[model samples]
Target: MLKHSQIWRAIDRLAESKGLSPSGLARRAGLDSTTFNKSKRTTREGKPRWPSTESIAKILQATNTSLAEFTALVEGDGIGRPAPQTLPLIGFAQAGQAGYFDDAGWPVGAGWDEIRTPEVTDPHAYALEVSGDSMQPVYRDGDILVVAPDEAPRRGDRVVVRTMEGEVMVKELLRLSEKRVELKSLNPVHDDRSLAREQVEWIARVLWVSQ
Candidate 1:
């Protein structure tokens, strides 16, 4: 049985191996920065607390890591690292334009740049370079956002959503249904959106951010 301490320790070790702080790893996983904070591990009464499986799954997907690999880190004190992978990359402005991606949202044609990352399990993994300071403190200019087009977008996952009209944006998924989708804006100044399913061209889960 995995103890609470072992689970939390594994998270810390995983963050180090990924070159991130605990908060940074949480952000990469599309979760609140404080999700992995030490303070969050236990109740005010000091009873043992465990990390949620959902949180673990998000981090694993964000880092392109498998459960078995994470288990090894837990059992082996965080030894071993996966090899780097090169992926297609493009600027956000370019992403909105046609010819950069196919109908299914896979990178297509040419003019795509490349970025080397670590262990992205999705073969359709790609990177979108943040364009300007518009997104502000959350996503800055030149930040590389790695995305997995084939990955299913779940509530609370930050996602790249493209509209049928050709607009593209990154927002946290609030709700998903057959008729429509709800999105929470990363920037507080921006209003949340509720778009009909027909209006969405494609949705891709954000797996990581290389800042």
Candidate 2:
């Protein structure tokens, strides 16, 4: 059972962790500054007004944090403070970085919008922000992508992968055999790539991308 007050506590903790005020956090999440304000938590008649799920999702997206991390904020876990970790946070054009983010679904930041996601029991599953239109026609700039590191991708599954030689790319997993994997780009203007299985360091199945 979810409690109403837990939402408030979560918001407070997230703001504090990000070194921002409630209003500042709201604004950063591209939400109304008053969305998390204490006054907004009540109605004119003094009835309790809980934060909307939409607003909460936006807040999470803006801060680059995952829902699981936000849960810790409410549980009073030690994660309320921000710690630097290499997680997949790429602009569409810059996603081609090397082994920069975790492939096993580690806890990314919080205060992010909830994009379309499949219900998974794993708490560390999360989405990353796309920066440019390079992955357009499939993924646009500012889009959020849901990634599941635990799932082994088969043929035709879109995935976020890092090459052992140091490069990250989000592409369709075209085919895979014992020794190699082939990938296709969403943009027709872009070409495809193939590599030996041993040359790949990690892969995460991309579940969704929200505009």
- The model with the greatest lDDT is 1
- lDDT by residue for model 2 (1-211), tens: 6655556766866787789877899899888777876546545332457788899899889988899999876665645643213233444334444333443324334333444444532234556787666677998877888775544466778998777766777899887666777889988888898988778766677876667
What candidate 2 gets wrong by more than 4 Å, as runs, is: 1-120
Candidate 1 on 1-211: residue-level lDDT in tens?
8666557667866887889877899999999998987546645333446788999999999999888888976664344333227898899999999898766577889999888888774545799999977676789999999997645566898999999999999999898776778999888888889999789888888998998
Model 1: CA > 4 A from native:
1-84
- Score each candidate by Cα lDDT: 0.80, 0.66
Report per-prediction Cα RMSD to one decimal. 12.7, 16.4
Q: How far is 114's C-alpha from truth in model 2 (Å)?
A: 9.6
* Location of the lowest summed lDDT over 10 successive residues in candidate 2: 81-90
